[model samples]
Target: MDNHEFESESYEEVEEDDVGHDESPQVITIVTTLPSARSHRLRTRLSLPDSGYEIDNVQSTVSANMLKILKKTFSIPNNVFLHLSQDNDLPSFPPEDKVTFCSDFFRFGVRLPLHSFINRVLCHYKLAPSQLCPNGWRILVGTLTLFRSMYNDDHSLAEFQYLNCLKASVCSRWYYFHPRPNVSKFILDLPDNNKNWKQKWFLISGSWGGELREDGVVRSVPTHFGIPGLIFVLYVHTCSSYASLHV
Candidate 1:
């Protein structure tokens, strides 16, 4: 929704702490829902202490002040919202109606655990506070940064898509599939004549801790959880090594 559509009635603000010092502003918490019909609820806690600014949890409310600030500052969509809960448990899969934005090779959905999501948002918020608001703008900007990085890869769009799909499939608890075969084929199909294939393969392999030997054998690294279900990384390393030797 456009920023102009945000009116005063779209959010509610609550004063959590009274102003004690002249330099310290009251701790205010704003709660509101997104503008779209499918928009989720959001809560933003703003604390203007003498040292600096701080953001806390998400809550419920009716006014649009926070939403307006977020829209004007970050241009975030209604599909994303802040969830400030401490729970780390995640469902087997994201909900059918949930929205997702990927970052750092991870697919973060609305239904994903809130702790990791909030931490990622906070990292960007600390770097560029002026570009973000207490609303979900931090998360939006962080997600955009990740998306841009993925797009900057020199590989073909199809390869990029396959990598993203492979990452999502591996990282998601609910994604059940045999990724090894497809991953192997994708690696083997890379052009042996391209020198850049080695670099691309290294990036993919390093991310998943897979390795390729000089003789072209691909092996998976041990993970804390167990043997990784997705072995596409092995293929990537092998392809990269092959391209390097051939080129």
Candidate 2:
């Protein structure tokens, strides 16, 4: 048989499966072209409001499929693809805030924007204030790098800079000011000393001191002691909490 005859036979064989089946139009469309009607189908499948699929169960498959679409649709470079696909731990669907942000961002794109469509995208991944650990920081850095690759225009560059500044500000506040010593321990333990010595150093440096305000706000005392002082304070606070728990 000629090449055309072989291709026609292959198409007929594929259609033969659908002959007796009662497949919905949606199923047929999803199987044919994901990008053409992606927004509606994906949103319905993901079912954000229904608590549909467990995040862990769907994350890998959803991310892989969405990344495939993004790479093809945007003609993203291989380097850019590597940057996004490297972080396998990112959620399949981002939080509502990021979903909203991305939906608005891509409103004018070819397809009708769906919040879930944007939610599946890697760039929309957001780290919670409490989740600002080493791994989370790596994700954020990777996301910023990906944005740089995706958006090369001057306007987008400014926006990228703004995002970086915002991330840095949020991280500094959570890492430095928050009372979660265990979370901050990695940085706090950097000084070359034992835990006891570190605690004593915190006491001596006046970094352990804070003042309670009328509004029930406790502000750290600014000793002008800089970064070392901050780490000492966090170390002492974490140690004290653990000690209290044991007692």
lDDT of 1 by residue, 7-123 (tens): 221101111222112232222222333335675333232332321221111122312454345334553445445221212211111112221122211221222222233333322
In lDDT terms, how accurate is model 1? 0.24
The 10-residue segment of model 2 with minimum total lDDT is 197-206
Candidate 1 TM-score, C-alpha based: 0.18
Error of 2 at 101 (Å): 12
Q: What is residue 188's positional error in candidate 1, in angstroms?
A: 24
At residue 171, candidate 1 shows an lDDT of: 20
Q: Give all candidates' CA lDDT scores.
A: 0.24, 0.24
lDDT string, candidate 2, 1-247, tens digits:
1223312211122122322223231111001112245442122222232221122123222244554565476454453321121122222222211211111111123122212212222212222222122332333334444544666512232232223322222212211111121222221222232122111110011111122233565433222211111121111122124211100
Question: Which sections of candidate 1 miss by over 4 Å?
Answer: 1-73, 79-92, 99-155, 159-247
Worst-scoring 10-residue span by lDDT in model 1: 197-206
| Model 2 residue pairs with clashes | none
